[model samples]
Target: MALKQSFSQKMEQKLSPQQIQLMKLLQVPTMELDQRIKEELEVNPALEEGKEEEEDEFEQEEYEEEIGEDERDFDIDEYLTDDEPAYKTSVSNKSKDDEEKSMPLSSGKTFQELMLSQLNMQKLTEKEVLIATYLIGSLDDAGYLERDLESIVDDLAFSQNVMTTEDELEGVLHYVQELDPPGVGARDLQECLILQMERRQDGDITRYTALKILEDHFDEFVKKHYKKITAKMEISEEDLKDAVHEIIRLNPKPGGSLKSSSKSLQQVVPDFQIVDEDGKLVLSLNGRNAPELKVSQGYKKMLQNYSEGAKLQKKDKEALTFVKSKLDSAKWFIDAIQQRQNTLFSTMTAIMNYQKDYFLTGDDTELRPMILKDIAEIVDLDISTISRVANSKYVQTQYGTFSLKHFFSESLSTDSGEEVSTREVKQILLEAVEDEHKRKPLTDEKLASLLKEKGYNIARRTVAKYREQLNIPVARLRKEL
Candidate 1:
């Protein structure tokens, strides 16, 4: 009998704690970085926003030399002695500037709050109120109660502890639908439109005709089969157009209007600003992107007191260890922030310079083909790192604010063998479609031909794909009477 032993060798890569922390910090956009910093400041007493004097102190060589010496040969075991009692350190008061941005209290009621208030106005039994409240909660952002009656019946019994039937829920839903938005609790698009139409004047001919079209010919109406609708209904062309227009004017998304009125609109915050100065593209990181940070001076003084002592007391030794640990964490965070700033600037600068012509002229056709790999190689970083920066960050130029990822597109070869950005192809395709005759809209085949004639060697299917990406409908749907 014989036994065998073997050995193998391989290389592996690992990330240190500081490296992992930096990678995570790099992915957060400028808008969220402030909140992330606030969180860190709350948890780490040794980390705080730097004052002007603290910034000046860090710049001095002597302070750095002293800090480096203290950190070089630190020993933790020297502090943990069996004879010594643990020392209690007082928690630092949070700086007022470290407090989170407080959102002002909204005076107006939210959509759901408004619905509940209206429900209160109805003199219903307690059970009816419970069922009605549950129904309102089931509605989606578009104000449609998409849940089936049976599911809602089961939900009421199980979740709300209220025994109810489908008929009772359906009866209560009608009252909820009578809310101010006119179509608040409809189950579908057709039902929503019907509810809104029922709110019009009783004898209005346009409303009557619109209701008839929607009630009986909804499928035909959606497909834009105006010819069939006119012939089937025996209506005049002008009258039919007016009826369809009336239906079009009704809100399909009633809940969306409620949401808009309830919430304030958010403004886009760009992470970088680019300017053209005498034919030179100047890049500046957003002021918020580079926040001032420093390790706590109080913590440093505690360490210095211990270091200067002739005989270290147990309390002093324990305090030194705690302060040193916090100081290390604070130092790591500050360095990571600086690295994040450097990486963001380097990546953005390379992108701006790479797409120089597009930035200079504000012409989308001038954009060159680029990918994460291209910029990753240029900046000497990983593809994932570049992707993180590109996906979450935005830049504002004289043209407009755009996501950093918008500039990176796959390469497409033209008939002349020139490599161009797919973005360029999409822009040209968009222009052709926009200029198309709606009565006889251009099909994907024609669109592809038009692009080829203009030097893009795109196929019909590819044209269809790009069209879909641009959210343009098929030629049949694009057709108008």
Candidate 2:
């Protein structure tokens, strides 16, 4: 017997406006931060750039307070005074109201647009085009449309008022696969490569291997079961080697050309730069993406003028309120951007210090075990906030630009009880495989034993896990013959 309650309390959790703001801010990248600010400026009339006349007094008071604190310190008058022209800018004081209203909205062709253009050029029947269009729409940003044929068929029949068969749609899918890039409409990796190979006229070794792998023993082929392949085919070691080479040459992704999974071209822009100055490393935040923003000085002045009037108009009061809210939002945004820069610099500086040996020597072996919590604690920020900064963000070094997330690797203890990075083990494993004899590839068990000899007590299963993470196939796949 179960007791059933007639009434249940509903639990509701709501995020603070500030938390929501921070979440939105975290979502914005360095490249888009300026544009976001400009967008805010356009939507909120109270939001303007540079200081208003009213804030000048407050700014002076703050400056005086800092200067008064220490007379013996370097004079701050130069930085504060208008005469010094340190903060003077040609565009900073421009009229905010007239500028934003006249700007045109941006529009551009997306991935769908490009694909639709190709479809339009093809001599497709209306029904075929409808199916093709629906199929194209179903695909994700990775260019993968994982839905089954039945679902698509149902969707077309019900929504488009067009009766279509899965077989017919599948036929059209084949036609789409034969479009630009050779393997666009393939259902999976094997199909994609096979489609490309089917279209190729050359009977190269790579093509032969690709066809064999796709048509037969695809599972074993992917798992690197080269021995099974050779045993079943009764092929010589040399022929097997050529077959494997051929398979390696074919593109794994069929629709990669249409929509690459890598960061969008615009997103590749680095957020920070580290330049050597004199004998020290100087880190500069790319603030160009953070445009100049300030409260609407004219609006604030108007509010002050209206406040003294005996009776303020309804429109005027509404305007004043709107101006204040927008000004506050603008100020909050600017402050958040400033805070973001400081936090980013501080966190990165701490990382650079912690991993000084790795940076100075450029040795992967020297990379110490570091987690987000370690840096978060050092930088006095929450781990989640630190993660937000690291995610999808790139730091440019003299060697090359790498994602900030690359530096943080989980720690692994060796057989000797010495802690090291898992990256180091992966690197060592990669090197060993690279140097091993290709005719007889080293099995995971043999790799484990070799690692044990090298004082790395990793198991065979663990070796497989690491190898898989590195996108390396097993010993059989690595075999040439």
Candidate 3:
């Protein structure tokens, strides 16, 4: 046998250059297309924005040139030449790219930054400043520094190469709490409220009332145990009202300021809008972020010039091939954007039409049965594709802004053997909870029985599952002392 090797050769996994380009285009959303185009212009130097008059003239001339061509026998494959220039016309005036642009630099500093800026004004030792920095980092998304001193001490030691103890962190936490936005770094609600209260110069009964709520009657206060609260605090109705107001005024989540630290709030520019125009609903795609992209005009000119002037060298051929591949990719991306826009409209329009009654009245009860498959069949798209579009995408309807995925629900059988959406059952469950007496909130079994009485016929476990989805606590946890 011809030299047979004992060891098997390894196959290298590599993506084709065209495949890489497609992946890049797929990663960019419709909104970021302009930024992507501008970046390409800076790097390639061949692309240029056409003047309005020039674009108009080009369209007229191109139309005239095609007048004699057979209307019924059009061939896109033939027009795409090996050395031809690729051009893309703007389809709409509104580009999605505007939303991705940076906010104006003139915007004022946020509440959290104002607090940190105030920190610089205070006279403090280097160690105190270092500890303060460490403490600020631990605050959660809600702006509360919910973590304990030991965890913070460990973070400082690991991240800053500075040894710290619980005592050092505790002192820093106390000082930071005194900073502007009074309860900035408090470990809990009680501490957050107490810090804000201690700063008040009046020394009113409010502080004492807050102390009672935070220290002793926290359980009673949360459950809205007004009778028990007034009796235990030994206060009159008017005094109890004032104290309850003070407690309510305190920051429940201390670290709410931390949200400003990372970056400014994202302005949610919706990708689609469904609005009520007269009695009929109008659906529109926000193409403001989408840009008109084509092969760089310079790259196209270079390829044409080289191909016409001389026989291509190996290097020149390689470059031309690369440019052609990129041009193909650019065309595919433009097509995909057009396709994505079409699919979005087709899918959402079907949704809007299906739930027209709900949108018109702004009532959840009128929401007709819908699922991914129902939309998929209507739009002629795969269920998974529909799901992907719906998952993160939001639509601004007359009723409100909602995720497209919110409309999808699994089927449930009714008494007459008709399959109803599980969403209808959830709505009924919510109504039951909302109408129930808070003191003796309906238990899972009672909720299940009520759902059955309403002809839902759902199991107790299913009722419990739906209850958890609504974020309502269990009967015991929901109970007041």
The numbered model that scores best in TM-score is 1
**Cα RMSD to the true fold for all candidates:** 7.3, 9.9, 7.8
By lDDT, the best candidate is 1
Question: Candidate 3 regions off by >4 Å?
Answer: 1-30, 33-113, 119-173, 200-207, 217-242, 275-280, 295-298, 474-481
Cα distance off (Å), candidate 2, residue 210:
7.2
lDDT of each: 0.81, 0.70, 0.66
**TM-scores of all models?**
0.85, 0.69, 0.72
Q: Arrange candidates by TM-score, highest first: which order?
A: 1, 3, 2
Cα lDDT tens digits, model 3, 410-465, are 78887777777787788888888888886688999999999788778889999999
lDDT of 1 by residue, 1-481 (tens): 8999999999999999889998998889877887898999999998878542312222212212233455446643232211111111111322444344433334387788888889877878899999888888888888999889999888888888999888888889888998878888999999999999989848989889999998999999898888889999999878888898899899999998777677765456677889999999999776453457766767765665555555555665567668888978977887787778779889999999999999999999999999999999999999999988886789999999999989999998988899999999999989998899987899999999898898887889999999999999999888766
Cα-based lDDT at residue 458, candidate 1: 85
Candidate 3, residue 82: CA error in Å? 12
Model 2 residue 301 distance off true place after TM-score fit, in angstroms: 1.0
Model 1 segments more than 4 A misplaced: 1-8, 52-108, 120-127, 157-165, 260-265, 311-317
